[model samples]
Target: MAEIIEDFLVKKDQGYYCAYGDFYIDPLYPVQQAVVSHAHGDHASPGHQAIYCTEATAAFMQIRYAKQALSSYQVKDFEQKFHLNGVDILFYPAGHILGSAQILMIYQGVRYLYTGDYKLQEDNTCEPIKIVEADVLITETTFADPNVKHPDPKEEILKLAVASNIMLGCYSLGKAQRITALLNQYLPEKEILVHHSMLAFHRIYDKFNEVPMKYELYNRKSMKGDEKNKVYLIPPLTFNSYRRAKNVLRVFASGWARLQASNDLSLYLSDHVDWEDILTFVKQVKPRAIWTLHGDGRQLHAHLSDDLIIRDIFTQTYRPDFC
Candidate 1:
């Protein structure tokens, strides 16, 4: 019989360590060689000696990190299998954002996959989720609770029409670009204004030809009382601190609305797999074993036991003999 990947894996302070490939997956801090899952701040950071990821993710990294801070990068196209330390690694589209990926690792005859902040729902801005069947499936359980389910994003986007001039609170990166594209697609007649900080990423998105939309760098002169179908997109962190007029309605876009309360209307527009979608993905992949990442996955562990063996990666140590 051929050799197989072990039933156990290692957990270090940096991230999940892959012994067969001699690499780390989405290291929390700087490392010698890291396999990045995406360009999102929590999953990706600068100062790796060498980085391996999809081409689109590499482009996003260039936009986020200055060249001087990033040491080296190896760009891989989606579905391209590459060899590192005699181990096979593959990248599959993860649909969380523009360049997100679900990493698949194969050692000998056994396989494992890591879903890095993924969503199965449709988005107008980026690639859709690509499913990969593996012996072990590790997922980001951001919204794993049974009660949490995201409404259609276009329905949420349509809510902007209620206020003549609306102010949207979104993160400058993924959430901001997603909403911007949604607004353009669903409500093209509305005028879209964006914060200066988000303008740079818009150019990056434009360069990639992803989410092409018209937007103006925010200016007070653009403020008009006529306010029929006008929208302002700003970083939530910045918008909360600014001194703005009371006339415009404020709205927040996030999945955490189910758990937390926010001022004004909360639009459940998330890029992560919700509870229902998470279950659907598990059934689609049909993995022999499952592990949770991203958020506290107690609910998922409790609920998904009937489908597959739920393993806890954080508490596991490396083992070689058993597969």
Candidate 2:
């Protein structure tokens, strides 16, 4: 068990506590004590006994997991240290979403930082990412491959606007908000058209007082015969299946858009950091060991110097007990 703690586990006592970004989950540890990094579906699990997250995260969680009983979670503010199991833990903004956070834990003299899903680029919808030093850093390598580099957001948005009259397809949640905000800043008078899913998320953003624009939401029914020059925000699944109206152009916004399959005319606007940004962050933090998760970690590992030990952990299929 002790060896496992050194090799795979963070700490071993009652059960297992693994830190990823702002959330901590331990199968052996009480489920009631999990810490959520944000309200994103991939990061925040529904029906947990109790959760700790930022206030904005809590509000979004309420809207998302409304069926679950209220008061089952606790909201933790930024930079506040909370102690658990003799370890000091703190949450810092990750700049991926409105309430996203990176979890930093200090046990005895060792410090470990878990970056859930983060973006170093400036986004108008959320706070900017911050740099913190730690002994060990767990980060995401979503866009870590050497070939993946993104254009500046402002430049990309301008190109996207000039390339097509109709902007189609984007994640309705954080990504959509970001793209919309960019459009609002650049094309203030243009009316933006959004699908139902995007509308729902926009409503949530409005509820939280983070909406940067005054725009109208439109469904498929409402959009019929509406030929106004506007940006249409739709989920990827919907965009791929639905036939676009004649003269409508489609562009996919994601970190993976750099691939040959994803190069469309609109733009590849990503919410995640590019390869250069990842390396820059690693150098800034200078962690003793780097743990990479969630997408192409091996590619990232190969680029870094040998001095920084890179460990790729596959959380999707990872089970700590077997180790």
Candidate 3:
């Protein structure tokens, strides 16, 4: 069991540990020291003794856990090399959501890149992704299957422009703001009725200029045909409860459309690298070894030669991406 762990990171009872840095990476439970990758619920939780992450990620956490506060935190600017203990650390743009980052840790002359929930595609709602070179690459293979392909967001958002009204189901934090910004860019003429759950995140993104677009709050009960030609950005959880009107098209924005058929019209939008982009990223990063996290990596194994070392953490505990 000990031999199965990555050299740079040990799989501990609490989380992925780095003895050199004396900290955990995305710990499942709060710990004394943490090197957080982002503010998504699963990755960033309250009560950590201390955290090192991007400035935006810290701010988002304050909002996410409004009533609570972490013991302490240090903000790491993108691409700025910093030292924690004897280890060198750097954070890079991930393009998945506001303040999403890929962390690079260098110790003992070896470099390891941990991509904490990333997408290579362009997103106006957050900083664009930047490729990093390292000896070992830890990737999120959420859509690693050969068949998974995400349609261009602009093309999918354009479909809403032609519709009289849209009940768009998406993750409240990342997906909602992403689609909102896309609409602001391509369908600026149309009004967006955003759910209350997603409004705070939109404001947070706007506060950082991560999302410069504008939208209105949604009041589903009071909505009439008066709010025509609008897109109501609601939480994916509420997709079933959303009542459809004659002109309103009920749609779910997700990568699930690529893998399976859905009862509602699927937008096929995702804040994750598709199969082609995954292959492209691997080639560009050019790591000696690859560690897969958050999703299956069978697609990578099938294409990459047998000489490379590839470990999929999902083989232990597969879970959904916390958007």
TM per candidate: 0.91, 0.84, 0.89
* Top TM-score hit: 1
lDDT by residue for model 3 (1-323), tens: 01223656755556677766877788777687888888888788877778889988888788877755554878889998988789899999988888989989888777888888889888877899999888888888888888887888888778776646777778888888888888889989888889888888888888988347789887745357565777788886677675544567778888886422543465778888988998888889888888887777776876775867887643223222210
lDDT of candidate 1 vs native?
0.79
Q: lDDT values of the candidates? A: 0.79, 0.70, 0.78
lDDT digits (tens) for residues 226-321 of candidate 2: 555567777878877765455566677765644226435647788788889998989888787887766778877776646777776533444444
Ranking by lDDT: 1, 3, 2
- Total backbone clashes of candidate 2, pairs 3 or more residues apart or in separate chains: 1
Worst 10 residues of 3 by lDDT: 314-323
Ranking by TM-score: 1, 3, 2
| Candidate number of the best lDDT | 1
Candidate 3 CA-lDDT value = 0.78
Q: RMSDs, each prediction? A: 3.5, 4.5, 4.6
lDDT of 1 by residue, 1-323 (tens): 34435443456677777766778889777777789999888888888888999877887788788762444889889989998887789999999988789999888777788998999889767788988888888888878888887899889888776647777878887788888888888888888899887888777777776447788888887766665677788887766775465777777778887422644666878999998998889888878888787787898888878767885675444343311
